[model samples]
Target: MNIEELASILRNNYTNADKGNKVSAIHAFGVQYANEIKENNYLATEIIKKSGLNESYSTELSKGIKLYDYMKNMSTDVENDTEHELLSKLPWCEIAAIAMYKNDKNYKYTPTEVKNLPLVVLAKKIKKAESPSIGTELRECSNDMTTDYHRKTRNLFIRENDLYYLSENGIKYVEENFSYMISDDIDMPLNQILYGPPGTGKTYFLGKIKNQIMEYNKKVFAKKQSVKENIMDLSWSEIIALGMYKANKTNSYKPNELYKLEYIKEYIDDKKENGGATPECSLRSDLMRNSIKCDALSESGKTGNDYFEYEISKKVYKLSQNGIDMVENALSKYINPSDKKEINEDDFCKFITFHQSYSYEDFIIGIRPDTDYDGGLKFKEKRGIFKIICDDALNNPDYKYLITIDEINRGNISKIFGELITLIEANKRWGNEEQQKLTLPTGGTLCVPNNLYIVGTMNTADKSLALLDVALRRRFEFVPKYPVYDIDGIYYVDFLKKLNETILLKKKKADYLIGHAYFMDKKKQPKLQDILNKKVIPLLMEYFNGDKGCVAEILKAADANIVFKDTFHLEVI
Candidate 1:
């Protein structure tokens, strides 16, 4: 059963043991199981002595110690008394305090409400709190809370070993707001293709949802986290740095050289540049290589080996951006279709797949042959590297975790985002079956897990991204995020407003307007004049491109003029 179900059963069985008579009778039984982790009779005795109801079942509980198994065998009466007495001893106030940790952008928890709660109430409170991840101590203590409301509150938010979610609203919320694309059934390859129009938030949102689902695994692999998984997630600029390390070395060649290995490395490395490498992030800079695997033979209509030796032991393969995607698709096949289940066509996020070049580090290039380095010095993540991180954080009793991916669609669509399209769907994971692998262009394959999600992001304006093929577009779910009409924490609406007015005046339905993103200023707000004169005015002129009269007409509406004598204020570069 799921953690939520388990929490409910445990909570129900434990109620009413807090009262004087019930406590006296239940204390001993509670002590026996509580001390199982320690195997110390003295500790067990000490805890049991404090209980109003001492349990005689302690020895048997300590021997098996598996909560689910024990609960299955329990007569409702024994389980309830034992849990309530245990709740009486837990420090609810401390857990409440810890669960209330806060950060700059994410304030999902409040410190004030939890400070003075009674132990039993606090146990329930902590359980009900839904952070991205939670800890063992908190999970146990909350599980021990006997109040049905309190226990169910914790259960209302589901847990996947290291992840957390608002249980009741979890799936719906993710389908609507998360970045990864989710489906109810299995479809190979097309289940998700990051390079298409829906690539951005679709990839990212789905990835996050997968993380939350992962927590349900009963293994207890890692502790939980107290904060939102990507609260201080890297900005576009920071993301570029994560994947910008020298791929040539891993390609088994020296920089500025011409080995097939070096060729592939050079192609992948060229993705993060829009120009002279401006201080502004270069992630949205320029398209790196047409294919993740830079095989000259393929480029020249021939094909062969796609990888090389990395330093000594590891084999580094150069997957074309398309190659990378095929690999992900193959893996997704392993994840989604292994059970031979029927699926509907509408499961995919329909997209207009058009051809476009791509940059480095987007999800289109799922895996690359880069020098894997962990530890002191030697540069961390390269600019535009796409990697997913899975871990936990401390919320209550302990920490929770998250799995994250940045810029999901910057590479070649078909190559990079392979099998994830199928694996990410909710209904398609498996039915009493095992995992499989998706094949890549170079004959490589990848595997997907039920709890893993694929999330990615894209700027709709990029040139390379527009060229996705129809085959790939039919797989993912895309949620269009226009520039916000007004500024929130990230983007703004002033420029977007002025720009849209100008576009409408020229052609009402041209699908062109100032992006809601133009006015975004994390560091400071842009002045009205600065936006109009510098950023907007010139762009409007570019909109008309060569039509001087139409451009002049729109400028007058915004109260600005061309610089020529009869035009806008004049100045020649």
Candidate 2:
């Protein structure tokens, strides 16, 4: 029986048993399935030992059973009784307050009704009060809470003396908002290629990896944006508060008090007027979007708030004097006059891939015609994606940008990359001591940044790695992806293994064999006959170049009743 069914039976049988007998039965069962329990969950072993039960049955009912075991143990503790009892009877307002307290941002503004009250005191009031309308209080409090500076900043409208109020609407708002954090995980290889035989899901795997890369970038950006500058700037109490919030997100733990101060709650009235639009943010947004479109960035969409400041920093480094003035005018709307300063756009750039016919001019700094403000055409030195992204990374030092090349091998690496190929080396990366800054054809120097990562996808089934540029080959790390086997309860995987063994022994090669992914179906099991006729037989026919007899032999070995026809098709008998 499956674990769920087994668990249900155990629960039902023990529901009405004597407490002492139930504990005894649990211990007995644990001892009975000790080996299987040990293999399944490590946590279950600890729970079983602590509960005075045999370790064997822990694995079978860990999810449902261990939770009850934990509660029973906790309730027996004398010291936790008062806090636990109060926690069990908390009103919804106190519960909401406890949840909101975990976030540090919520401490920026307290409700006017509770303005002078300490967090603990307010929580007690919430717990003791009857028919408490926390939402109505918050609405009344908001009218007197906002300051002039709060009105100016769109993201911080509800801030008073810096302690945010908790209400039903506030809770919903925080829940809806996506948490941004810069990824702490940077375990990716400097350069790696995903390569495998035909239809082995190599390309599909590349897309998945790309998503992870984006997510990493998003997380880092999110966490970084959580507080001003770095999280190191937060005080000890604030750091502790943030940690509690993260723990709550993971464990779904409720507060012992009616309210807690371990989280942050931001009150964003989305309909609240977000101040007058500053021309700078709007112009910069337009410029970034236009830049992405002009360079033909694939899948370019609206960027998040975390990307806003960084994108503007890049634009400053790339645009001319006339462009800088326009940006300064826009910047004037949001930033204080004293804080406004010129930024160099000389190095930052977004990358775009040239599908075909890319040359030095397209890949590097080249003269391009552009219309002047007066509608007159003029020639200007246009920088490429490599120079731009690298420039931005050098300036920020913290932010990382990725330039992905789909079907990287299809491009003429030597012609497109030019002198940059040597610079692509790990040692030659921008921050390295031995970094090479080469003078371009236009008499300008360029360097690739250490923070910038280059990601690309390659299909070995279409072309051999031997066809790749030797220099490029040596620079990148190639990860081989062969056909997979050992899919649990998947007979098709075993059949493919047998077929591959035959191919490797007879044809003396592995690449010609079938990939296990071709038979994968997690949602609904596919028919063996359908898999062969539509997917398997056709692939085999192509691999053997219509050698029907050879295909038939391989099929028979795998116990397939499909027949190869003169039409170069497969049909199940």
Candidate 3:
């Protein structure tokens, strides 16, 4: 490939390589921008700048690099030709693309290579973006969330960075309207709507983006539920899954399984990208540490278990120590209204447990208020206030609870989120409700939290089914779900993404593949083939066998690929 060819390829795929909002990748990748430069121009300039030369020079360098990389890594040797001379002029090798040719071609260079070109380019960049720290946070909510995967995928918006994972179209929308999108009132407590026709893969793409963010360098939370194979087995499947989870999951745990896997995944992923080990590191066996032990692993199977109650007892001891401190300092701090006492231990522990296992319902509506704050305030009168709800409890500092309602529109929004109409905003929270008493048609009283973030999802089709009680709408920030594809390395995440695409294209029925829970798995994700074999084919029967698709109808949909003589043997096209 010559310079023009190379620049053409880069330009064509630049947007595709983006896999995300072009603006975000440009910013994160350090694309240079001036006041007059638009997002595309800005990115173009950055690519040109990074090529170690000007735009024109960069184009030539990129082409030469592409050609050199493609040929240098070829199985057959490149004789001394213009190619060799061009190699010197070429910029740094597209090391990833060359590796792809080597692998896909099985080291047998042919007339044409670049079979694994996409994988190589993506993996290379992904390696750079993979980090333990969350650099930025972007909020996105989507509609058409019939499937859980759709919602979970959007949930990945909060995974990390300002990069939100949405479908390509969603990304384009943001790219087109990048300026107005960046707003201070992201959490305006308003119900933002994203409306459009069906079959756009709106939800599917959103999930893919979200999954990427969630798994970004954090240890996957191996909750008790994920260990379906029995934690004891630790099969190749489970071990690999655990390794990935550890590598991608957030680093919150003191001794997480993912931390152990981080070095391994990083080392292995690097080797694959760079082709064998570089000078600095080698893929080693010692990378496997015993931090994730079967004996130490809790019954839940994801995380290490507490042993001899020592870990448990250690926490208990801390509590006791804190209690002593609180008791010793209580009278001086608690009695005096103006005392400058810091939050004691008792208050700290309570805050830690807030919103740990909260659900969609908890966010839209307030928790049932407590009937016990006795500073001459009656329980019924203080029902609208959060302080009254925790009135019986000590006056301890609390974490502002945030409830992220994934696909907030999917449920019976009005019924599911009742009475919260009056108390969803931060200002109108706790003591902000002007109404002393607000009751719902369902006879439920609505209370709002002062420190609550009711992040929600709204699909346009479903948006008709209103969420965010008019009161709740006024108090929340509604960020649109933007789809991002360019996460650097991942080629196909949220395998159901394709299925969701298929569902969108077909628009005639449900897509079993894109389940919301699929995106929530903190660890190993089943492949598309696996889903086809397991869930896709089986659940699809609900469609084929249901009244809509009697025996003959299934045959047509199967396109002769599926022989549905009976249930299990049903073929897949």
> Clashes per prediction?
118, 43, 35
Model 2: residues >4 Å from true position, as ranges? 1-183, 228-396, 442-445, 487-491
Every model: Cα RMSD to truth: 26.5, 19.2, 23.1
Q: How well is each residue in 1-573 modelled by candidate 2, as lDDT tens digits?
A: 334443444454456434423533443344334345445643554554544435664653343333333322323233434433333343333333433443333444334223222232334443555434444333333322544332211121243333345434344333332111111355566566666666576765655554454544443443343332223233322322333333331232122220232221121111122222222223333434433233323335433111111133223312323333433453322112222122222222233554558767776678899999999999989987667766766786765566666677778889888888888788988788988878988888888878777766665655678898898898888877788775353556767778788877766756676777777786888887877888877877777888888888888877778654557565766
Worst 10 residues of 2 by lDDT: 264-273
Top model by lDDT, which number? Answer: 2
For model 1, what is the error of residue 167's alpha carbon versus the real structure, in angstroms, after optimal superposition? 21
Per-residue lDDT of model 1, residues 36-96, tens digit only: 4344433433333333224553432333233323332322233343433333333332233
What is the alpha-carbon lDDT of model 1 when measured against the actual structure?
0.34
Better of 2 and 3 by TM-score: 2
Q: Sort the candidates on TM-score, descending order.
A: 2, 1, 3
> Between prediction 1 and prediction 2, which has the larger TM-score?
2
Assess every candidate by TM-score.
0.33, 0.49, 0.31
Error of 2 at 67 (Å): 16
Task: Quantify all predictions' global Cα lDDT against the true fold.
Answer: 0.34, 0.50, 0.33
User: How many clashing pairs does model 1 include?
Assistant: 118
